[model samples]
Target: MSVTLAVNCYERTYRQVLAPGYFPAIEQMNARTFEQVIALINNVGDPREAQDRAAALVDCGEITGFEFVSDWVPAALQHWRLGHRHFRRRPYLLDYGLVMPLVSSSEYILGWDAETVLEEPADWVSPSLDLLGSDSRVLHASLNWPPARPQDAGVEGDAVARVGDFLLSWGFSDQVFLISRKNMLATDMKTFSPAAIARHAPHPYTFEFRMESYQRASRKVRATYEPVRYRTNLQIDGVLDRTGKSQYEGFRTEALHRVEYHITRQLPSRLGPRWARNASISQARGTKQG
Candidate 1:
């Protein structure tokens, strides 16, 4: 018999809490630009005709280059808006969710930042396999895309190798420090749990990445580097359990056998250590209580 997967569609928003001041300034600029573009869209007698005229102007070379301040904003916004609308209405709906199971295990990729690799002393840098590998100094990757399924059995070393290769191909990580896996599910699909969703919600602020700049030393010069820290807030708006017929009125029966991946980067990490630590801790505490 075909297996059933309880697919959850989530909306994720990344809020940058701690970063260089310039980052927020740039965000404000972008927001203002977006508002101007929306005003232009509203001013047109016919938005479609305006888009057609813009395209024709481009084809005739009347509009040759973009001016970030004004010229290209309308076209870019309209293009993205229309393209996303078209994608949502398509039959395949792969962008909406996964149709086949892409990941069967939960794993994390850990390593040192490039700055540490290039500048820090070898002894000062700790490998991820060490007891203190989970230290704050280590870089932990966030796996948000292609949401992973819960593995019921311990992941083998070979399986980790394969998953590591997959992550590399997708530009997720360059190095793997350690692989941590757990058998959390007892069956293929579990009943929808609101408690589970609530438990997975993000905390106020978490480290995202560190920015660094380096200057090489010459014959009469000295080497120097500067580091800037950044933290992120993951806001989970809501979740839709598409597997239930009653909950999802238009649920497709054919979708039962297929697992949805929810390719949109909007889906938060369900597997990696950075995000799943709270859930794992709760599970451990629950096991002790039992």
Candidate 2:
């Protein structure tokens, strides 16, 4: 089965808290991570769209190429003009939440958070896929929260709970997960409508939309936790600002300090990074066509 890595990187909102100088460093870190992930995708031989067409859209030292997913743009922009009190100024539901799942041809899609850095090269989901057996439909990571019965659960498990014929998880916004195309398409079909997003602004966090998707799709969905461990530099304690309030109250704005890429030796990757490799290929193709 094919796999597509759908990652969300919203730099505009993150800039709110990070110092002006930190953006350059953050851009470097993102480029490095993008390069590493591309290498891994090539090594694993997972089929994905050739990154050529989308690469040119990458901002200077930034992975903004994927921002083309804009199904939610109309509604979001209208909200912006009307001065809606959404937490995030710019949201990724158009790309990450709405568009990716609904349109991807990959049999399995991995949702990755851009702020995270992987310490080593690893095929993160292969083992979990094997163990969960062919019958399993979803594989996810754990959040730092105690599992409890969902408030509206009709059936409950120690770590799993079902509600209204659907399953709900406290996985902390699904930072990482492997989901089946069938489940995603099912959820897209059942809960969210293209018209809805076009007509009205949904929650900017996108959590409620995601949970509702999970609920409608849970009938055929059986999910398992991933087995790999990740290293993140997210400082949980003392992250609050001067007023004893978290700098990122509803969103994250921490600088990309202590990233794995910063500590590792830089190498000449075959694909380079930040969608540039594909852009080069696209440029060459255009030249040949001309």
Candidate 3:
């Protein structure tokens, strides 16, 4: 069955009057929440391995990650009505959309355009938000006075600008992504990551922005901010393969998946979605998900 998109409950209003001093509190709370979820993910397996995966990305010139906060926690999954598929379904975070971080991801939120989905752990962009730290935050910040139009997205740049500018003012390494409907449009900073920026092809000087940091300046300045913490029940699911059991009792799932990808690679003569029309790949051949 297809999942419907919910109206975003988290309003984008916080940006208009977002004061400079508020970052520490937000970051502290977010980091702690992220860490707790990481602990849960660790309990499921080797957190060190996950961390190593994140760290290794730094070496490979890519940033990879898994969701930190998950629906698996009793508290976290209070809102999740469904979970990702395994065999009989796995335990998942309640708020799988925002809290989960990438596996092997240290700072999972930071990365380039190519790396965003390419380096993302699994289904981050497809059916899930996975994190709140995205370029959309900037778009929300910018569109402060409108019902919002479709073109506003394209006319504007890809997600981050003012928000990134604000983060830069605060002195922390910041990266943001704002892709929707699969690269229909976007605006990105050249200096999103210093490490990655250095690797930019065709000589680095051409990129428009410079990467900068705030927390690393001095111990006294860093130690001054008080950290804020919030806790939510993180959903934790244990995934196990079902082996060769593709046939089960209970309710059956209709064919909701498109053979577009499969047909593209497996049968060049068949143009997936288009071919599906000729093939009549409809759910239940006539019935629908009810």
Instruction: Find the candidate with the highest TM-score and give its number.
Output: 2
User: TM-scores, in order shown?
Assistant: 0.20, 0.42, 0.22
Local accuracy of candidate 1 as per-residue lDDT tens digits, 1-290: 11111111111100111112322232232221111110011122344554554444345443221111123323432432323333223212222111111221223212211111222212211222232233222122222121123452212210111222121111111111222222111111212222222222221000111000000000000001112112222132211233222423224322321212222122233432222211222111111110
**Sort by lDDT, top down from the best:** 2, 3, 1
Task: Identify the candidate with maximal lDDT.
Answer: 2
lDDT of each: 0.20, 0.34, 0.21
The TM-score of predicted model 2 comes to: 0.42
Better of 1 and 3 by lDDT: 3
Residue 134 shift from truth in candidate 2, angstroms: 1.9
TM-score of 1: 0.20
The residue-level lDDT of candidate 2 at 244 comes to 48
Worst 10 residues of 1 by lDDT: 210-219
Steric overlap count per candidate? 2, 0, 37
